[model samples]
Every structure is written in structure tokens, then in C-alpha cells.
Target chain A: MKVVTKDKGVYSFSPAHKPVEYVKPGELIILETEDAVGGQIKSEDTPLESIDWSRVNKATGPIYVEGAEKGDTLVVDILDIEVADRGVILVVPGAGILGDSKFEPRVKIAEIRDGLVLFDGLRLPMRPMIGTIGVAPEKGEIPTATPHRHGGNMDCVEVMRSARLYLPVFVDGALFAAGDLHAIQEDGELCVASIEVEGRILLRFSLIKHKAPEWPIVELDDHYSILTADEDLDKAVKLASEQAVKALMRAKGWPFEKAYMFGSIGVKLAINQGVDPKKGARAIIPKTLVTLNDLLIESD
Target chain B: MKVVTKDKGVYSFSPAHKPVEYVKPGELIILETEDAVGGQIKSEDTPLESIDWSRVNKATGPIYVEGAEKGDTLVVDILDIEVADRGVILVVPGAGILGDSKFEPRVKIAEIRDGLVLFDGLRLPMRPMIGTIGVAPEKGEIPTATPHRHGGNMDCVEVMRSARLYLPVFVDGALFAAGDLHAIQEDGELCVASIEVEGRILLRFSLIKHKAPEWPIVELDDHYSILTADEDLDKAVKLASEQAVKALMRAKGWPFEKAYMFGSIGVKLAINQGVDPKKGARAIIPKTLVTLNDLLIESD
Candidate 1:
């Protein structure tokens, strides 16, 4: 077990360019995180006339997982989250999907009180979840705010407690970094923000070899989730459906057409993320009616 | 209130097509309903090899609401549901989103025991909600299975108890009919079906003269919802965003651009329906973020 702190813009223990050592499954690692804005703004601070957008959204790590190959899945088991006295603030400028002209001089502040995030006289149950948690993509550095195949900024609420997130290991060691904690957020976070806050997160990581998905997949207590993103909701849904069908096919060994038909006839589809315009849509196909054990998987 | 029953594909009612009427902001009305199949299939009966598709979704009646004019909004308040001994069943074949392929023969049976619908091995908390409740469309008779401006076959689980559903009125009397009760369902009944059953429903209807929206709007406690459907998810989301902007503009008299901007900066979106291939997407917007009080036409 190891503990690390991120002060200002520097990490207490910065790793070199090489891959960091891996920690086995059920190992506890604690990381103290900063607010999404990196403490640039305070509670009494007024809305910025012009924000230094570039300085925001800094992730904490490329913490390498041991033995995690390209095709393997990195299981991030979120153990617990401790919110700081100060939380996150959300601002929507002119560049979002609704565009900029409609919202102006908008600033909403949330406070963590009695285990709840209070915003605009509404008491949202404080369900601390990560705003951005993912691995590095194969190419250039992907912005922490943008969600992609590497699972950045998913803004998915169900990734909260007791959920095991299985992310595809794109690069070796699966350079993992997580920050931008939210006290509470709806699925879309339509207003483009949630109760963003600084927090301490405890996560347990495990590596599964030779078991990587083309995209990320999640398995919770009662449901299985498939994540897919596209600039278009239709295309995104189609991609998600295709992936879900493929998962079903692999799990059930049913013919492709039969899997598709079973999905159409028995599965349930849910929209996971839609507010992020860049990654137009994300859907989840839950194996609710059909039991996973009923399907016989034929090894590839 | 009127009582009706169907036996052997034949129905008899005390008040037949006599336009059941209620006022705006009225209390819940209890209606005794028949199954979607209209008694064509029974508890012991097997799935029909060929269901009369036309007759598969026959609803109870066109209950005309008093003072509901074209362009007005009808608020249907679901109160409670009481399922009978035997419920409904779903069979997938040539119809549905995956109509292109054949699936294995699967059957699910349901029973109501002590206010719970026991389906398979799960005891789903009975939250009786309508699967087909709507006004007559401006066009010719639309099937009970398809949803349109009239709000037919919405199958939205949130439209249950304590939720207020607003339907845009098309015809003079606002011919409202409701049936196809379900015990429970997720956001998208990806199986293209739910725990469909025959149940007694209690609902209250009210009318709002000048508050009719361009599309359906639902209010569940503090959250507001907008339903949209298109050939694709992007278009569907765009349509939903546009509708949400329109609702905000109409309610707050903000400029269209401002509404869009406000939505971009402040709203949250959720997928309401995805089972239908033709139209699959629903977006939810919070009323608190959008300044609706500015356009308040004498608040209720």
C-alpha cells in the first residue's frame, strides 16, 4: 500500500518516463486529489471574465499496473471517497453543445453539508464519483475533459459505489490517472457540471490478462454495461448495440443474427452519457431478462 | 368512473365511447382495464404463432377530458395500480428493432401477490404505469404500440405514481385512452417489452390551456423530462435539445439562443426510450436551472 499527495501542480512522487511498478489485485492505494480547477478559484471568487481553460483538468497519474498487456482489462475497484470541505464548481461557456449565447454570467457553487451537496437550494445526496478516470490513448495526450475509448470524463453516475469498472489496457502498464471528483452528478450533467470538488480517493486495482475489450465494459451487482461513443447518437447507439451483440455472442456462442435478435427481443438499452457533445452518445445494454450463466461461451 | 371487462376477445362496458371526461388539476381516476391483447391470450395459453398484429395492442377507450382543446396540455397523474392473478407475456418474432433475425423461444410469466408482481425469480415492486396512454393523433387512427405527439405507448417507467405527465392535445375532446399496464421496467425496455399485465389503474387528469408544449413533457418530483424520437441518436438529441430550448423559451420568454445556451450550460439529459427503432431517445431537463418563473402565466 502506498499514499501520494498532489500539491499545487506537482506530484509528491513523480515517476520517470518509464512504466511504474505494478500493484496486484486487492491492493489499496490512496491519492489525494485537487479540484478540477486546481485550486485556481475559491468559494468567494467571482465568475471569471476569461478563464484560463488550459490550466484546468490536470490528472494525477500514469500509475502503471503490473502485467497489464494491451489486450487485458484493468479492473478499477473504487473503495471509498472522502470529500474535502470545499467542492467543485461548474461553469458553461459559449462553446458547449447548447452553445455559448444562451448561458451568460452563469456560476453555480455547491457545498458539502451533512453528506450532501447543496446547490441552488436543492439537496443532492452526496454520491462522490470520479469525473475523469482512464488510461492513456495510443496517440497524443487526450484532454482530461474529453471522453474517448480510453474512458476519460465518462460522467457516468453508476460508476459510484460497489461498481467494478473494467477498462481496456491500450498502452502497456495502462497508464492510469484519475481526478476531477464530483460530489453528486446526474447522468448527463446537462448544465455541463456537477458538484465538482477536491477529494481523497481509495481504489483497489487488479489486472486481467488476455481479457481486453475493444471498448470498456462494466459489471455491477445486477447489470452489465457496455460503453460506446460517437459524434452522432445514432452512430453511437449502433456502435453500442454492435458491441453489446458481440458481447452477447461471445458470452452465449449464439450465431450473430441470433444474438442480434435476442438483444432486440430481450435486452434493455440505456443511455449512459449524452451531454458531452464531442462524444455524441453512450449507451448501455443490460442483460436483465437473460441470465449470463445460461449462455455457454466458446473460447476464442 | 366506469367499470369494464373483456372476456374471450369481446368487451362490454357500461359507458361505451361516451367520452369519459375530467377537468384540469383533477384527482386520480380509477379505471378497470383489459390486457393489451384484449383477452385473445390467457394465462395457460401458449404464445400465438401469429398474433393479429393489428389487434395485439387494442386499448380501452378514448376518454375525452373536459375543456381540453387543441394545443392545450393534459396532465395525467398516475396514482396506483392493482394487477390481477395472471399478467401479460412477450414473444419476439418478425417485429421489433431486431426484426431481421430469429431468436430462441423464451417465455416469462408474471403473477401479482400482495401488491408485488412476481416475474421469474424477482419480486418487482408493483408500480403500475401505463404503456399506452394518449390522445388521438391528428392523423388517422394510430396503433396503440406506436408513440407520437399524442403520447401513445410511451412505456416510460418514470410516468408512475407521483409523476405528472403532460400531453399535447390534438383533438377537441383530447381523446385519452390508457392500458397496457406494467409492474416495472427500466429506462429502455430493450427487450421491447416489460412486465406487461392486466391491472386496474388509478389516474387523475387536468388541463392547462396555454401551456401546451411542442412535445411531451413529464415532471417527476423536481426533474423535468422531454421526449424526442428520430431516425438517429444525434438527430434525436438535437430534436430533444431543441424541444427543451423551446419549452424553456416558452416558459421563461428567454430568446431561443439564450435558452439553448442556458441548456448547454445547465441542463441534464437522460435517455427515456430506446426500444423503438424508428424513434429512440428521450432527454430530461431540470426546471430549476432554466428561468421558467420569468414566463410564469400565473403560477399554479
Candidate 2:
């Protein structure tokens, strides 16, 4: 078992960065993560303007996996996520879906105990999830705050423990990185931030050779979601829906028309993170209808 | 109980139409509805081009409720949905999210028995819902295929039995109509059609005088979703999120910031229908956090 500490973090995902640790396929590893704000907000009384914005969204190590190469799909199984005792949620002045609305910069520190998030005498269900996770892209560097085909900062709710994330591999050895844990987050992450927390994730990686999806996919118990991001949700949803329909067509060995019609009865489209500049959307296909093999297309 | 038969249906919702039935606020009524295609696709062998497109989406009634008037919110509780033994699904040549894509005008009829929608050896979960339900608008007419503040063909999955739908009243008596039943449908309704079925809906309407929202809303067991539709999903989602944040602000009596921040941890943004010309989106807020009173703004 290997463990990458929180101190080793990267501000962006790029092939230029050296791998912090290297492991063989099927090897189990642990990733220690810092909060999205880089632990800058110490308490509710902490001034919001004092923190450095550039240092925010620091993701932990690009752990390279042997045998993971370009034209392959990196399957990372998230086994467990253990969050810290406390987390923070913030409201920024000009960030979020409601950017034009005026608001005082406020921060609230929440307690995490007994598998519940306690805020103002209310107990919220704890649904721990990874907020930022990605591998190096084929070409350029992507900031930790954005999500692209290579998967960065896709604050998707399904990226939780007991789910398997399928990221398209690019660059040899597959420099993978993940951080920004949330104790509990709803689908949209509407106000720009969630109950951001420090945590440790236990995961294992495997490779699907010569097959990769156009975008990242998350496999859960009953469904697989195709994730996409663009400057707006319309483009993202269109791409996700198209890819999902294609996968369904392949799975059922049917023409595009039948698959397209059947998708209305089975596939669900949702927003993952609405507040980011590149809004994230997903097309969730039921496992009863499609499979992992259907989503990944072989690249000749 | 008064019953509105399927034969007395209207193609468009307008203030110019005559009310078929009248009832008190608390009185329950049954609405007999035709399928989205006006019950024309009787079997899989039926040609898709044979059906009259102009007769599609015929709502059963413009039921007038006593004491219901303009500037009021009409709250209708969906008691039960009794679907017929058969349903039809279709893929029109150019009538879906993938409208531009080439496809044959295909039609498929499904069997509904033992509380299940059986389609081609697959037993889909029966989640019968209202596809088109609305009151007459303040002025002019809106075709039943489009959704707006008046709540026409929202295609929202949550508009099922046990849910409560809130529609804003425009003209006096809240001239309400509901039809277009779906035996089962996913969130996006990605394709043009779903398991369209004829059904009977049992519902009762109550009113909140002088209190109305900017859009229609659906109240499920654990959450309330504000529904909005626009030419694009981005605009719909933007308006929905802002309204949800505003509701939170009223619920907790907190200034804009705290409610906006907490909304990130509590609210969800989702698509109800993507195929319609006006894409429908919603902001689902947890019932544990906000009450229905918070959503109904005083119009006076």
C-alpha cells in the first residue's frame, strides 16, 4: 500500500510535472488531501479577503500508474473516504450562479460527527465525495478549478466512495491526481463552495487497454454517468446525451433511432456543478440497460 | 366526485376557452386523459405518419375552482394515476433532442400489466406521471407542448402520484387542465416521446390567495422543486437556481449570503425535459430546510 501526503499538491494537472509516486496496476493507494481553500480559513471569524485565491483548489499528487498509457481508460475504484472532524462553507461576492446578486462574504464552519454534518442545529446527511480528480491531458495543462475531457474539478456527486471513475488516459504512465473533499454536497454545488473538508481516499487503479470514452464516466451500483463540461450547460448536456445514445446503440445492437427513443424512458440528465465557469453536466444511463464495455470505444 | 372525460379535451390552453367543470377548493375530481398522441397509435404496426400531429397533446379540462382567482397559487395534489393497459413510444424523423439526426419515424407499442410497463422483454419500473398539466395563462394562448410559468408540458419525472403541483393562477377560477400521461419517463425525456399512455388522474386543488411564484413548482415527499423553462437549459437553470436561493433566504430569514452558501450544500439542479423547444430545468430544495410557504411569494 502507498500513501501520498497532503503537503505534496499541484495547482494544475500537466504532463510536465514529475510523478510523486509510481505504482503497478491493481495496487492499492491512499491519497491525503487538503480542503479546497488550502486550509486558509481557520475559523468562522477568519477574514475571507486575507486568503490567497491563487493557492486555492490545490490537488494532491499525480500518482503515476505503470501500464497505464495513451489510448487506454484508467479505472479508479474509490473504496473509502475519511473526512476530518470539521469543514467550512463559504459565500463569495462575485462567484456562483447568482453572480449579479449582492452578498456579504460569509463563512461557516461545520462539524462532522456521527456520520452527519451539523449546521445551525440541523443534521444533514453525510455523502462524502471527491471534488477534483483527473489525469494529465494529451496536450496542455488544465487548472485545478476547471473540468475538461481529461477530468479536473468535476464536482459530481457520484464521485463518492463505492464508485468507479473511468478517466481517458493520455500521456504514458497516466499521471493521476485527486483532492478537494466535501463532507456533503448536493448535485449542483450551486453557490460555488460546499462543506469543503480535508480527507483521505483509499483507491485502486486498473487499465482498459485500447479503449477509452470521449469524456469521463462514473460507474455506481445501478447506473453509469457520462460526464461533460463546457462554458454552458446546453453544450455539455448535448454532448453527454449524444455519447450516451451512442453507448446505448452499441449495447443493444440497435440503430440510433431505437436507442434514441429508448433513452427517453431510461436515461436521466442532470447538472453536476452549476457554479463553475465550465458548467458540468452528465447523462446517467441505467446499468440494467448499458455496460462499461458499451461506453468505452476502441481506438484503432 | 366530478369527472372530466377524455372526449372533452383542448389542444391549447387559453383564457378564451370555456370551463368544462366547476368545483370547490377542497373537492376531489377525476380527469380522464388521452395519450400524448391523442390515443392514435394503437399498435406498433401503426404508421407514425398516419396520426394527426395537430391533435396531439389534448388536455382534458379547464376545471374552474371556486374562490380561485388571479395573483393566487393553485396547489393540486396528485392522489393517484390509473394507466391503461397499453402505451406507445415514438421516434419522429425530426422531433427530439437529436432532432437534426436522421432517423426513421418509428413507433412502438408497450404492454402495461401488473403495475409494470413491459417493453421488448424489459420490465421498466412504473413511475406514471403527468406530462402536460397547467392553468390558462394571463393573456394569449400557449400550446400544450411548451412549458412555462403556467406549467404546460413540463415532462418532469416528479409529477407523479403523491406529489403536489403548484401553478400560478392568472384568470379567475384558475381554469386548470391536465392530460398527456406517461407510464414511465426519465429526467431529460431525451427522445421526442416516452411511454405515452392514456390514464385517469385523481386530484384536488387548493389556493393560496395573493401568493404566487415566478414559475411552477412540484412538491415531492422530501423536496420541493421550482420549475422553469427557456429557449436554452443555461437560462432555465440560471433562473431556477436564483429562485431557489431566494426561497432559502425567506425560509431562514438570513441575508442573501448565508442562504446562497447553504444552498450549495442542500439544493440540486436537474433537467426535466430537453427535447421540448423550451428546455425545462428545476432547482430541487430539501424539504427539511425550506417550507412551501417560503416558495410562494406575496404577489400583492
Candidate 3:
């Protein structure tokens, strides 16, 4: 397996960035990713406010997936996420869901051992997940700070190990990149940060030809998570739930009302991160109720 | 166990209504609830639009708790929810989160048996939950169609069997009422309807002396869910997460930043229902992470 090192990090996902590594479909590779803060605040002794913002969210790669073309779906099976022994979490005063609340800058370094995140005096079971992962957009570029149609920085907890993320291919070769790993994170990520850690992601790339859902989709153990994002949380919820209903209608050959009614009883609309510029919303539908093919029904 | 029949239903929760049923603390009682449509539309035979809108959301009782007072917290332990054999689900064109979407008014009658909701050629596991359950507000009357701090029509799926719901008392006797049992429902009732069904709710009432959470708090088997509502989802998300962080801060004697950071990695902010007049949002914190006392730390 080829390892894409952390030195090949990109600040933004763009078609302008040339591919640093090339691999054929079904080729498994490892990408060494840096933390969200570029792994700069090692122990939090440094002031969080003075850190260079430009160096933030540095993602590793624009790994070219051969045979992945525009209008195709890039299938990335997340096999495993191996994290470092230690990670960092910080609370910046003006940078979270509760940004207006009076709070000083605080930081904590956590130790990962025996499958638990040892923080302060509490031990939480490790749930390592990828926070930033996607391909180039249709036109220009999307910064690693925002998530949209091309799936950047979604911060969805369901993007963990054993999940398969399907991204809409906008540019040829699916200029794929991923970074910002979290050892563990809650659903909303209220403070805009989690147990940010550097890790190596093991994933295999494949392609679904000429068929792609409007937004990204992640297949978990028992459910399909429709990842959709918008600046407005209400709009995000609309997009996510609409996609689920549309797909279910297409799958079962049911009319609009039947699909809409089934969605009310079957799909869960959850928030991924409310603090992000493009707040993440997901529709979690059980595999027993919906399938990968069902979600791709709107393919053009 | 004493049973409170379905005929004692009220269209709105109010201090104006006289007590219909009275019970001592820790006394188990059953409230036989009407469907959301007040059992008007029995099956697909009746035209959905033709139903009497005036007779909607008929909840059962003003079950007065003997010892519950204005300053105390009324503890309601949900023993069991026995749903009726048949339930109806309808999609109205001008209602719900996707209200603007082109859809016809379609009704589905689901059969409940063997712990399964047998729908249109599909068998789904039955998970019954309460949709409208609350006490009277401090001053004015609130219709059963809207949810607020007083907790009406929340449509929260976690309000299911085996969940202990803690509500804040406003007036004497804690004038409690509940109805709108859903045979099964997703997190966000996007279509404004689930498997709308009538059911009997078995409950026991108790009191937490002079202490109450600002919003409703439900104790599930593994986690404590803080239910909050707002006209705007962003505000609801803010309220839910703020309560979680504030409670955690008071619990472990941690300062602002520490609690904020912990919340990002621990508390899950979930959307309960977006289609309601007041959208429901909840912060789901694991029991091992934060106790019920931690959440009630702000009580005076």
C-alpha cells in the first residue's frame, strides 16, 4: 500500500492543484493527515488567539483516482483510522456555536490508550472519524473550512471507520483529499472543535459511473447518512430530508405522498455541526428501509 | 393502576380548565389518548381535508398531581405505552417541513401486532412514543398543536416507553395532560405526521422538591435528553447546547472553557421536530458523563 505523507497537504480543494499521487480504482492507500490546527498547538502552552489562521485546516492530498471522471460517484471505503497517541482540544472565545458567551481561551491535551480518550479525569471510548474529506468542486475551489456539494469539512460523526463515503465527482480524476481527524466528537460539535488528532486514514477508492446523488452520502453499519450542508440550518434540513424522500420514491416506485409519509416514520434528521459556516445536516435511514441505489435515483 | 379514559380530552392545555382527574404522588394511572386528528379520520375512506380542523389534537386530562406545586419539578415515569390496533398517517399538501413540495393528501392505515407496524406492504418494528404531553404554561393557554417551554406537541421520538420525563410545574396541582401517541416516528416529523394512533399511556407521578430544569429533561436508559424549543432552530440549538454546557460546568466545578470543550466531544444536539410551530431541539448527554443533578444545578 502506498502512503501519502503529510507533506503533501493542501489548504483548499481545487481543480488547480495537480495530483501528487495517482492510483487506480480499488487501490487501497494510506494518507497521513495533520490535525485541524495544522498540529501547531502541541501542548496548549501557546496562546490560541495568536496562532496563524492561514495554516489552519491543512488537508493531505489531492490523490488522483484513475478512471474517476466528472459526473461519476467517487466511492471511498473508510477501512480504518489509526490515530496518534495524543490529541488536542481548544476552546477559542469567539469561534463556536456559543461564540458570544463570555469565555477565556482554554485547551486540553488528551491521551489515547486502550481504546479510550483519557481527558482530565474522564475516559471516553475512542470513536475516531474523518472531519474533512472530499473532491474538487464543479468550478473553482472550496476552502477546507466550508462544506458544500463537494463534501469538505462536514464534521459528521458517521464518517468513521467502516463507513463508505460517496462523493459527487465534479472534476476529472476526482482530485480527492482528506484531513482533520477527530479521536471522538459529539453530534453538533458545539464548540467547533473536538479531540483533534493527526492520523493515517486507510481507504480504498472506487467509482460508480455517471450516477451521483446531489450531495454526499455515507453508508454506515446499519444506515445510510445523507450529508447535506447550507448556511441556514433549516435549508440544510430541507435538503437532507428531501433527498431521502426523493430517493425512496424512486426506489419503491411510490408516489410523492407515500415517500413523504414513509420518511416521516423512517428517516431521522440530525445536525452534524451547527457552528460551521455551512452547517451539516444528515438524514439517517436504515439500510433495511433504503439502499445505496435508492439514494442515487436522481442521477443525471 | 387507575385508568383515565379518552373522553376527558382537552383541545388546549390551560389553567382555565378544571381538574378532571386527581391522583396521589407515586400513584400509577393510565391516560387513554386520542389520535392527533382526534380520531376523526379513521381510515383512507374519509377525505383528509374535509376533517374538522377545530377538533384537532385532543389531549387527555388535567391529571392533577396531589403534591406537585408551582416551584417543584413534576417527575413522570413512563411505565408503558399500549397503542391501539390500527393507526392512520396522512400527508397534507400545505403542512409539514416540506409543505411547499407538490404532494397529494394521502392516508395510510397501519396495523400494529406482534410488535410490528404493518404498513403498505412493509413491516416496520413498532416504536410507540408520545407526541403531545405537557403542563399548563405560567400565564396563557397554549394549543396542543404548538410546543414551547411547557412541552406540547414536541413530537420527540425519545418520549417513548421506559423514558422518565421531568417537567417543570407552573400552577398548583401541576395540571398535566398528554396525547398524540405515534406508533412510530422519525426524529424530525417532516411530513407533520407519523403513524398517528390512539393509545393508553401508563405513568406514575412524583415530585422533585423545589427544583426544576428550565426545559423538559428525559432520562432514557443510557442518556439524559434536554428538550428545548424555539421558533428558530438556531436559537433552539443554542438553548439546548447552552444548558448542557452550563450544567456540566456546574457539575464538575469546571470553568467556562473546560465545559465548552467537553460539550463538543460529549453532548449530541439533535433535532426532534422541525415542522412544528416551535421546532424541538435536544441535547443528548450520556448518563455516565452528566447526571440528573448536574442538569438541575440551576434550580433555585
Index of the highest-DockQ prediction: 3
Cα lDDT of model 1 overall?
0.62
Candidate 2 reference-contact recovery = 0.87
Whole-model alpha-carbon lDDT for candidate 3: 0.90
Per-residue lDDT, model 3, residue A204, is 97
In order of lDDT, best first, we have 2, 3, 1
By TM-score, who's the top model here?
3
Question: What TM value does the first chain of each candidate achieve?
Answer: 0.86, 0.98, 0.97
How do the residues A1-300 of candidate 1 rate in per-residue lDDT, one tens digit apiece? 866565523221122334333565677887777777776666535566556767677666767777776767788988888888656454456544454434454555567888876654555568788777788776666667777678877767767767778787767778777777877765555456566688887888997776566666666777767676665655555666666666677766766545554453235565545656445344455556434332212223
Residue-by-residue lDDT tens digits, candidate 2, B1-300: 999999988888899989999999999999999999998887788997798989999999899989988999999999999999899999987777787788788888889998888877889878999999999998899999989999999999999999999999999988899999999999989887999999999999999999997899999989999999998888898899989989988998878888888888888889999879799999999888899899988887
- Candidate 1: residue A125 Cα off by (Å): 4.0
DockQ of 1: 0.24
The true-versus-predicted C-alpha distance at residue A70 of model 2, in Å, is 1.0
Classified by CAPRI criteria, candidate 2 counts as medium
Candidate 2 deviant stretches above 4 angstroms: none
Docking level of model 1: acceptable
Note the Cα lDDT for every prediction shown.
0.62, 0.91, 0.90
lDDT of 3 by residue, A131-229 (tens): 999999877888998999899999999999999999999888999999999999999999999999999999999999988878999997888999999
Query: What tens-digit string does per-residue lDDT give for candidate 3 at B1-300?
Result: 778899998888888888889999989999999999888886687887679998889899988899887868888999999999999999998888889998778888889989999878899999999999999887879999888877888899999999999998888888999999999998989898999999899999999978888889999999999999988887899999999998888778988899999999989999999888899899999888877888773345
